[model samples]
Target: MPTPSRIEHDAFGPVEIPSDRYWGAQTQRALGLFEIGEERFPAALIRAFGLQKYAAARANAQCGVLAPELASAIEKAAIELREGRWDDHFPLTIWQTGSGTQTNMNANEVIANRANQLLGQPLGTKTPVHPNDHVNRSQSSNDSFPTVMHVAAAIEVNGRLRPALDQLRSALAERSQAFADVLKVARTHLMDAVPMTMGQTFGTFAHQVSNALARMDDALPRLLVLPQGGTAAGTGLNAPAGFDGFFCATLSEVTGLPFVPSPHKFEGMAAHDALVELSGALNTIATSLLKIAIDIRFLASGPRCGLGELRIPDDGLTSSIMPGKRNPTIAEVLVQACFQVIGNHQTITIANASGNFELNVAKPVLVYNLLQSLRVLADSASVFARRCVRGIDVDREQLTTNVERSLLAVTALNPILGYDRVAQITATALRDRVTPRAAAIALGFLDGDEYDRLVQHPVNCLINYPTVNRAAGA
Candidate 1:
C-alpha cells in the first residue's frame, strides 16, 4: 500500500509530499529533481540554516515586517532545526542548485510547516506562516545561503580546527623541550649535513603549525562579514532598511561570534572568495602537516636497518608477512588525511572560479569540500597529537652513532682549518671509512689533543655538551 502523503501547491502546481515530513512542496520537488549525488549537506550547514532562519524571523519582526506571534512560532521552529531536531527534514544533496536555492527552500518549507504545526495547524497548511513570504521574509536564497556558509565555516574553524592545531603544537613543543639536550645529525636533501639538537627539529614543526594558525586568523574576518540583506540580485529589494543590522546582531548573539553585515553585498553574493581564502589556509596547514608526518615516519623508519633516530609508538599493528615489524600508523594516517585536504583545496578553488556575473552556481559543492577539509584536518591533527607526537621516543644510541659516523661533522672544522682542509679531511674519512677526527689526526693536520680541543668540544662544534662528550668517547 502507498504511504499516506498530502498535496502541497507551489508555482509549479501541486507536489505530493509525505504527510509525516515537515517539508512542503518546494522541498518535495527538489527531492525528485536533484538526485545527482548521495552527498547531502552536513549537519553543521543545516544548523547554520536554522540559525539563519531564526535570526531572519526575529529581524523581520523587529523591522515591523512580520507579526510577533508569527515570528515567535518561526523562532521556536527554527531553534529546533538549528538544534538538529529536524536534520532529516533537510535531505537535499550537495549537487543541487548552484545558488543553493533548493536547500534554502528546504529550510524555509520545513520551518514554515513546523511553525504552522506549532500554531495549532497541521503540516502543509501554509496558513499562519508561508515559506516564502513569512519564513524567508527579508532574505533571498542567494544571500541567505552564503550567510550560513560563513557562519558554519567560521564556527568550525574557530571551535574545532584551531583547538586541534593548538593541541598538536603543544605536543610538539613539549617534545622539543624534552629533546633539547640530545644531539642529532641534521639532514639536507636526504644527506647528513651537520650537528643540531633534536629539539631544534621539533621546534621547526611547532613553528609551522603556528604559522598555519596565523593564516586562519587572517581569513576569519572575511568569514564574519555576511550579505544577508541583499535580496535577489544583490539589491535589498523587498527587505527593510535595518533588516541586515538586526539579522547580524541576532546571529552574533546566538552563535557567540562577532558577525557583521557585508559592506558590499554584491561581492558576498556573487563570489565565495572568503571561503576560498579559508580553503587556501587549510591547504597550507595540510602541506605543513604532511611535511611533519613524513619527517616523523622517515626518522622512525626502522628498528634495526634504516635511520631509526626516532621510535614510533606501537599500537599493536604489525605487517602481516614480515614478522616483528612495527609501522608508523598514526603518522601514515595523518599523511593520507593531509593529502585529502590538499585535494579538497583544489576542488574549492575550481568551484570558486566557476562563478558567473551575479551569483556563483557552485556554492553547494564549494562549501561541501571546504567543510570536509576542515573536519578531516581537525580530526587527524587531534589523533596525531594524542597517539603519535605525544608518545614518540627518540633512539639516543642510534642518534649518537649516526652523528659520530657522519662525514659532515667536518663542517665544524671549517672556521678553524679552512674549507679546503676540511674538504680534504672529509674525503679521507669517506675513503678510509674512519671517523673525521681520526682522519684529521692521520692527515697530520692536528694531533690528538689539538683535534679533541678543536672538533670534540661542544662549544666549537655546536653540539650539545653532555651528549657529544659521550659520542666522542670523552
Candidate 2:
C-alpha cells in the first residue's frame, strides 16, 4: 500500500505531509520544492535554532506577551530539540530559502506540535500553542536564522576547532623539545641552505598553529554579536521593548557564553561580514595546516630514495603490490581537508558579497559551507596530531649524512678566509663532486688540521675564535 499522509494547511493552501513525521505544512512544502542537495544543516546549527527558539519563548513570557504555561511548553519542547531529539524531522536541504524560512518554520511547527502534545492535545492541533502567533512569537526567519548562525559558529570555533588546534600545537611542541639536538640540513627553494635543529623545524610549525589560534581568538568578539531582535526587516516590528535584552541574557545563561544583541541589527541581518571574517581566519589556519602537512610529507617522503629525514607511523594499510611501502597517508588526508576548508572559505566570501540592500539571500549556503569547513578542519587536526605529529621520529643517521654532505657547511670559512676564497672553495667542492673538507684540502684553502678545526666545529660557523678553538680542541 502507498504510504499514509495527512493534509496540513498553511497560508498557501494545503500540503500533504507524511503521516508519522513531526514536521507540518511549510516543511512538507519545502521538502517537495527544494531538491537542490543532499546536504542538510549541521546538527550544531540545528541545535542553535532550538536554543534560539527556547530563549525567545522565555523572553516573550518574561515580557508578559506569551502565557507562562505555553512558554513553558515551548521551552521544554525546544530543549528536546536542542538536545538533538527529532533531528530527522528537519529534512530541508541547505539550499532552501535564503532566509532559511523553511527550516525556521520547520522548527516552529515541530515545537508547536510537541508542545501541544505535552498539553494532552492531539497532533496538528494549533490550539493553545500556535506555531506562528506563540511559538515564533516575536521573531522572523531573517533575524532568527542568522542569530543561530552566529551562535553556532562561535560555539564551534571556541568549543571544537580551537581545542583541536591546541592539541595539534601541543603535539608539535613535544616533538620540538624531544628532537632539540637532532641537527638537520635546512632547505631553501628546494636546495640545501644551512643547518638547523629538528627542534627548530617543529617549533616553526608549532608557532604557525599558535598564530592561527590567535587570529581565531581575535575574531570571537565579532562572532558573539547576534541579530536576534530585528524581526522581518531590522525594525523590531512586533517585538516588545526589552525583548532583545531578555533574550540575550537568557541565551547567555543557558549557553554559558557571552551572546549579546548586535548594535546594528541591519548590518547583522543584511551582511554576514562577521562570518566572512571568521571564514578568512579559518582560511589562514587552513593555509598554515596545509603548509605544515606538506612539509611533514616532504620530510617523510622516502625510506631510501627521497628526503627520508623523518619516519612517519604506518597506518597498517599499504601501497598496492608494494608490501614494504607505507605512504604518508595522514598528512595527505590533512592537506586534502585543508584544501576543502580553503575552497569553502571562498564560497562563504562570495556569498557574503552577494547580499543585496535589506537582506542577504545566501544565508543557507553560507552557513552550510562555514560549518563544514570548521568540522573538516577540526577533525583533520585531531587525526594529524594522533597519527602523524605525535609519532614522527627523526632519522638520526640520515640527518647526519645530509648535514655532512651539504655545501652550506662552507659557511664556516666565510669569516676566516675572505668571501672570495670561500666562494672559490664552494665552487671547487661542487665541481669536484667532493666534500667541502676534501675540496679545501685539495685546493690548499686550508690544511686537513685546519679544515677539521673549522668545518667540524660544534657551534656550526658562529666564527668566535676563542669559542671555536675550545670546541675544536674539546
Q: Write down the lDDT of every candidate, Cα atoms only.
A: 0.89, 0.88
**Residue pairs in candidate 2 whose N, alpha carbon or C atoms collide under 3 angstroms:** none
Can you give the lDDT of residue 463 in candidate 1? Answer: 32
Candidate 2 lDDT tens digits, 1-474: 989887778889877878788789888888888888799998999899889999999999999999999999999999999999988889989888788999999999999989999999876777789999999999999999999999899889989999999999888877877777778887999988867778778877888888888899999899889888899999999989889999999999988889898888999999999999999999999999999999999999888889999999889888799877789999999999999999999899999988889899899999999999999999999999998899999899999888778888778778899788888888988998888888888888789998878767843432222321121122
In model 2, the runs with Cα more than 4 Å from the true position are 456-474
Q: Which runs of model 1 end up more than 4 angstroms from their true locations?
A: 458-474
The lDDT, on a scale of 0 to 1, for candidate 1 is 0.89
TM per prediction: 0.95, 0.95
* Candidate 1 structure quality by residue, lDDT tens digits, 237-340: 99999999999999999989999999899999999999999999999999999999999999998778888999878889888999987888899889999999
lDDT winner: 1
Residue pairs with clashing backbones, model 1: 98-361
